[model samples]
Target: MGDEDFLLDGRPHRILSGALHYFRVHPDQWADRIRKARLMGLNTIETYVAWNAHAPERGVFDTSGGLDLGRFLDLIAAEGMHAIVRPGPYICAEWTNGGLPAWLFQDPSVGVRSFEPQYLAAIEEYLQALAPILVPRQIDRGGPIVLVQIENEYGAYGDDARYLERLVELNRAIGLTVPFTTVDQPTAEMLEAGSIPGLHKTASFGSRSLERLATLRTHQPDGPLMCSEFWDGWFDHWGAHHHTTDVSQAAGELDDLLATGASVNLYMFHGGTNFGFTNGANDKGVFQPLVTSYDYDAPLDEAGNPTAKYWAMRDVIAQYAPVPEERPSAGSPAPRFEVELDRAAALFDVVESLGTFTAHDHPPTMDELGQYEGFILYRAEIDCVGPAVLEVDEVRDRAQVFFEGDGIGVLARTHHVHSLSLPRDARGTVDLLVEDQGRVNYGSRIGEPKGLIGAVRLCGEPLGRWRAAGLDVGRLDVVRRALRPVAPISGPSYRAGTFSLDESRDLFLDTSGWGKGVVWVNGFSLGRYWSAGPQRSLYVPAPVLRAGENEIIVLELNGVPHRPAVFTEGLELGHTEF
Candidate 1:
């Protein structure tokens, strides 16, 4: 096929694409996923190459264990479909620190998604490393890679043309030959600032707004008209109810787009898990940690199962374009097992003795290591006699204070810096627990400092001689093996039990009764879920499950022993964490 065949003379190229993060879905399911995309009449598959996923440790890349981007691209090509690579040095797809490795924050000089010299140098290294794997697969090289996105949704951050140009030039210098594009809301100023030569500018629209299309046409009349990110569903954050967009309504909107001769890309064809500490927050000043399961109520659920939305979208696309003769069948069988553990215990009860410190002289500040994600514990003793006010001067985030092993008060940074009055009787020991929650992930002040920034004090005296405890509980292996807590299995602990199956298929780990924590199978950390608010259960991909007895471990925060955890054959658990 010729290049012109893909793009019409007057109209924009009719590219129906879907965004799927490679790390979320199992590596074995890559081909099946691409086939499913094609079956839904999708010609192109857009994906974000998560920097953290490929390079979990700084300077140490792991393309093994289902993270092979080359293999993923090959699968897309084998399906005879095009690919749009969004290899964001920083991809804020609700990923932790916007797909950035937390270790990067260790260096106080590194600022993200900007023109900072040190930051740009790191970005250049990343591009140079990733270019060889992707550039050769570009459509110009007879491969399926058609377009490369510069920075994602830049209008929400900043409109510096120089910054945008730097990104385009950086990618081009690293040998990306395909056409380039920028995705942003349909606006006049954003259009002018985010546009580049040889790069098409597309507007992001919602609710079938022809006015948006008119605005894009009026602003950049010569550019391609496409919906870069069509919101088929929404994402869920902690402490928020599960979000569900009307799939039928979304299908209708998609139909309207196809009828109007517009090219559209589903923001998420399959919303996969944030996985590990890669989940991100928004810019609303609220630290919204995304649920472990990124099942954004899309066509393909987190486990790669076809949802009702999937069929609806498939039928809608069939009306406009030619799909495959038969949809790809589900892949091989997944391993399931139950193992009775010796016992499970709480961490608080296992410690031999708790350490004590003075809260009068040593004050805890968020500036110790700069703005990083997670919780920081500060312990100190107060010398004041009688009742005193616990003042967390400039508490950048949230703080929970306990005086003499008694809960004193709670202060939310979103609300007030100083907590309520604390009743202290003649020089008592005090402990201040502060959780960073997370930095804002989107919008203008994306580079704002996160976590606690200043010191904690009481009654006009700075707390001194403190012990810092970092509570980054998501690291499964580290947390499980820590010298924290382990108890004898008094009752049930979702023990690993195995059953054989002739063929591999999707399955769901029902976490109905368990409290919030992480789940691991065959040594792979599935993701984090909480009984409080947000995600209740998790999607276990079949590729990760084996034919024999598979190992499963559950780390419950609350530890309810009587209630038994269950499993199902498909991804249809209905419990919401609202």
Candidate 2:
């Protein structure tokens, strides 16, 4: 028991594991994904719990919905699989707020991933609420959870022993007595910082770097050597080309690890969709935000089909943890079709009715207002003439500037246009509708403000009296829609239509030529779509679609559809060849 080896049910484990976040994958497909993982000769399945997803707000927590933690663990047990749960106050799985509840910012001094008392207090509240659910399912209590990880990747951040100690204590206080472990890059500093006196220390890497793997064993020579996270593939950013990991090369590396008698967990055996605004951003160097799909080019494709990586790895796994399972059926083709959304409605007309507006003297970020995801509308009157330029500061992700009701200019998170030139005689109610495309979930800029966090000026003078209204773009009500003749549309407009499908299967909404925006099918948010090349189609699962008529809504950032209307068809992921 004092040894460093991970003991599952009092026995040493050479666990073969694969990672899959339940929050990323649709709840309905949990069984299929888990089953496929097991079939691939995996003995254990790993997942990171999203705190923001479970307890979105402060006091109020929705453990149900798609984020039913209890149900998820139960399903894992039912599938005859063991689990390794990573409940992160800051998981950093490329998730918005790093899986942290954005409401934590209600208190200005709440520091993240540290021993800040306020932050710890919030973590305590979350653990107190969630631990009971998880503890009951621990292996000791006859459940599937074996290894419960501490605050994820703490070594990479800092050697905050106090914070790490408290996290361990929190889990223990909740009666979680399972063996604990942590994973970080196999570096001297990371291993030293990540390792507690007795806990298992594992290395995480995506390559067959013998030096790093050897370094891990040298640093952590006590228990079983494990590659806690072998990144199967990389994640794609909003404007960047999709990333693909070579199947054969990766499998070859995995083979070497298996030969070393090391336990392994595929970083993402099945990379699901980011769905909604839960997708995270990377601030390593330049601000690069992740795309909607988490199709990590893993063994399982985005649609949960076996890829070349799948078969290649399966062959390697057989030599080690042999298992016989039929290659799961290929993913259903995402057939594309066209629908004419003749009904168009402007959000400005219905935003006032959807939610109460928050008024502030100066601009405040979404966090300050307890707003998490969606659009924040800032309205202010500007008295300017004679071709004066208008500028807005800290335009979070994307902003559509309007003079009166006509578009003046658009500002993307990339800071393409900081100031807009005033049209000949521009004067009226100035509206800056800013969209929080995503929170920078990783690197230094974690707390980057959203909406207009700085000054708004007409040329040089700082302006105030900001009227901000948060648009819950993810949740839509029966917004008053009207029939409009086929004509060109200009500003941020919401389009709706009804499409009938007799046989429902996975479908791809092709948004090519249409301006960037979000897509929803039958009221289910399918995530964002940008015509900036790379990703042009949004995957709409069949479960959300009905046999009769399915309701479709498209939130066009700027309703300039090069095509007559957005259509559905095959998925054409990656950057479009110029």
Candidate 3:
């Protein structure tokens, strides 16, 4: 890089890039997304590596299918575009646990993003495993990768300069030769704390491009200014309105950033699905979990179709860079259909055979029981005398309370409701099925464990001798096997349906009628869908469907309504707000 500009082949070069996470999009569509990105007048594609996805378990690491990082880079190179990689052990991309493996926090001595020996050692192991794939694909090694990022947004989290230094050393030790970069919001304190010696400091903001870049210039001095995360739009939560940014205004901001001779990367060129239980939550004052759709309302919509915003942004880019003469074609219309959930199995009836429950004198948290994601059931023999109050010390996310196979009520952490009135003279086993609705991905509440924490009380008296069982929604083979041709059951039941299709086409399963539950198609999880608000349909990619017949299973925590599961040709993300 030159004193005031980025240099390529001894000449000035500006990086026009957009962020599209490979793990978020289907592997079959990676090439399609990359081709469209190139057609949009971009020269580079950037992505954040999700550590939890790659290394879900402590010793297990996966790089095949959707998690294939090498193939993603190859696709970018094939599109003749440069690449920038943010390999954060902590990437707060609204992902579960900020991409840190859940098992990493099981150890008490390991301090996250610190100089703690155990944490650093874990980071080193991850980098060592990841380097071989990236080392051979770097730009210096005749590959597309041009820049490698250090810890992501470190300054916003902590001021451990030594930790940043250790990350640099770890990358170098892994044979990474590309220029290192760090991203943070443009603030004196954050930039100073997140920045390290010799690493290019880039700002992450959506507005005030000139002012934000000036702040970056003050810190970077001689280096070329860049906006690593130009957030075009925002993500949605369950109850909130869908987020959107003004097309004209955002395009003008892009023009302003480019006018300053600054490089830019659109935060989400195409935001895809959170699929399964990978979505994250936030707890700043109140706990709000992210919706399943990671569709950040970008230029490319969740269905991979280019929107009006795409063309406006393209016009802005065309003034500065080359774009395709012919605009890309829109995606084909999605197919619509309906499937009736005929078979059913109640969770309460099959809980005993589905998994084993360990007897505990006191209820243990999901993490304490070695269970990370999914629901944990706590059952105890409670003798209710007269009208009494039932309370749990804390309910992480949400929980459904049952007594003698009857769902009395629901307690959600979001509303801070933990107690309910029980029936008079109730005597039976009390069941509390707590669900992990994605871990917090940002702020000081990042690592807070899920499930019921502390005591379960009846009339202000603590209950004991509880049996805890983990019902991992991801591993539901037993539940599938246990399904029978039965009538609709009440409360927290699994229902199955089958439908025939002539061809595989992208479709949306509208869950507006259903209360709350997770959906699985042909054994592959499409993630959770709630009738609450914001997102009402789950995007079912064509790849997960079969040519002839497909089976869908819904674990409706609340009883399934009489209406059939409807499918739509388009997405309905509810009301939008700026």
User: Using Cα atoms with residue i matched to residue i, what is each candidate's TM-score against the true structure?
Assistant: 0.83, 0.95, 0.98
RMSD of 1: 4.9
lDDT of 1: 0.66
lDDT of each: 0.66, 0.80, 0.89
**lDDT ranking, high to low:** 3, 2, 1
Residue range 1-578, candidate 3, lDDT tens digits: 88878888788999999999998888998998898888899999999999889887777779999999999999999999999999998999999989888888887777998888999998989998898789999988899998999988999999998999999999999999999999999999999999888999999999989999999999999879999999999998888899989999999999999999999999999999999999999888888899999889899988788998899999999999889887789978777778888787777767877557999988888888887888899998988788879988899979899888888999999899999988888788888989999999998777778898888899889999999998765446767777788675788888888999998878899989889989999988999988777898999987888799899888898886656778998988888853
| Model 1 TM | 0.83
Q: Which stretches of model 2 miss by more than 4 angstroms?
A: 1-5, 9-11, 480-487, 562-569, 576-578
413 Cα displacement, candidate 3 (Å): 0.5
Order of candidate numbers by TM-score, starting with the best: 3, 2, 1
- Residue 149 CA error for candidate 2 (Å)? 0.8
- Candidate 1 vs 3: which has more TM-score: 3
Tens-place lDDT digits, model 2, residues 103-135: 776666888888899999989999998877899
lDDT value, residue 551 of candidate 3: 90
Off by over 4 Å in 3: none
